[model samples]
Target: MWMGEGFVSEIQHNRGREDTMDDVGHRYLRELVQRCMVLVGKMGSLGKIKTCRMHDLMRDFCVSKAQEENFLHINNILSLKLCEVQNNKVRRLAVILESDENYIEGVKFNEYPYLSYRVCCKLELGNLNYLQTLVNVRPKTIQIPTWFKFNLLQVLKVRNKKGAQDAIQMLISRCPLIEKLHLYGHLKKLPEAHQFSPNLAKLTLSGTKLEEDPMETLKKLPNLKILCFRQAFEKISKYESVGRASFNGKNMVCSKGGFPLLQYLFLGTLYYLEEWRVEEGAMPSLCRLEIEFCSRLKMIPDGLRFIATLQELKIIDMPKPFIDSLNEGGPDFDKVKHVHSLVLKSFCQRMIIVSS
Candidate 1:
């Protein structure tokens, strides 16, 4: 049984007693259940139940309510793929809109004035409000209200162009519990502020220009596992407090302790990198490594000696020296024992091998 935060709150408020549908929010929730609205999850204490599907009737009800009052007034409404109700809702509602073109007009963050004052949001939360999961959607630079401050966030998928580093900084500061982060689209600069979240896990940063101590900030994510810098940095020194630190031996540096739990690594078009530090047998948990379009990478860091668990390896579009070195890993190479797949993008020719 999965219910949204709003429903969970109502249930908690009415616990150990008769459940009355007096509150307008509560009434709508009851009506949704009584009507047997085929919601994705369950209807009970807000955080107790989980939702897997969205009910069409629930969506229609919201639209009708908005049309009747000429505006929507609920504070928290969890939505998925409901684009048809875009124009109806007017004010004071937290909503999650994913992959819906029809609701684009009404789904803009600028439409709501109440977000800056309360923690209300349409984002998903399983049992704690500290962690939220953001699904896939178009990239857009959104202004987070001043009041939003969750402690833990598991998933953050923002694919809009307006995605700014400042907003990400604000989110990191507001929600200290961010563990898994995924950023898409062009995020040009890193926040000037020096803040960190130690509980992070998988990170995906794509199509952004790095002008600051992106790695310096990354050092703060002590629990990181998978790292993806997909075009996140072009000039690492632009955002740094000092410009010299950007290109002076620091740009290609790796952490001294290195990533202990790191499992996967992906880098794209690293133009400024002359060397990468693996910290002498670091990243003991690394298994999969993929490099693409990195012209200046001279050789693999010695830190790879620590990876006894590596299985899958991919090297694409690199200099011949780097490719030649990859084949020399000794007989006990962790990848050979565990890694059965090796994909070489540059020199592999198409061949059809028919199996019986």
Candidate 2:
């Protein structure tokens, strides 16, 4: 259990569903802490709790309750003994590994279920059928099991170590109900628009290299609400392309009506990005925009002014000139003056504002 900040509420809103924590998400978590049912963990820069851990007693209590209610099963892959009786009636299974020596050698998955693997183990997935959620901790590529069915899968988070773009695309193509996907590691190329998941709501690409303009393809994701690129998107040239030679005069443009439902966008550590253009009507629903460590980027997209729904804009560790241009009476001030909250941060200082 963890303090979701606004993440939980945001997910509910993005899915067009009422928030389960509508009236008291934080209050509920706070009450749990007050009752000693949960232990608080990490805190964010804002001094708000970001994560929460459970005490051993609380954990045991939860596990017992879950088993009694037929809510879920927690399996320890590393400590399983022949004397233990596995519960086959549980519909949700969370597999955890206690050590590197443990392997997924004999886990059965014939029932329609939700499976979460909390370890970086190399396991064959062909025998699993009717899985709803899967989180593979390892970045290694595994062959798709022949008995695997993707139609029922809704959430997938995995890392591809071999830069297997094709393999990822093939998996995505088969999952019609897929909603959230997080892909980590190098990706030489992204899949074409036709192969995109129609219901995909959130997407994250971390530590990947895009051979072409990522926006050109990502913009077509009809229901995408959250888009993030972390240390992703690098310049590829036949020769060394750093500094002046890297993306010398390149630009990325977001076309009109693109990312129709996007609410948040984050671009970080894009070392070679020098220019980004946003066309009017693009990201019409965008509520927050953040750019970080993109030293070469010189300006904020002028078209951002047209996004009436935008409420926040943040620039961190960017070039000094870029931040200066967003200051009051600066060249681009008028373009972003309408945003309710604007924050600009340089190496040693930060400026925050609330528009009139």
TM-score leader: 2
Off by over 4 Å in 2: 1-78, 82-96, 99-106, 116-122, 137-141, 145-148, 232-249, 350-356
Name the weakest run of 10 consecutive residues (lDDT summed) in model 1.
Answer: 111-120
lDDT of 1 at 307: 57
lDDT of each: 0.53, 0.71
Off by over 4 Å in 1: 5-103, 107-131, 135-147, 159-164, 185-194, 232-251, 328-342, 347-356
lDDT of 2: 0.71
Question: Per-residue lDDT of 150-244 in model 2, one digit per residue for the tens?
Answer: 77676788666555666777777767878788777666677787787899888887776665778889899998988887763334676643321
**Model 1 alpha-carbon miss at residue 186, Å:** 4.5
- Going through the candidates in the order shown, the clash numbers are 24, 1
RMSD of each: 10.9, 7.9
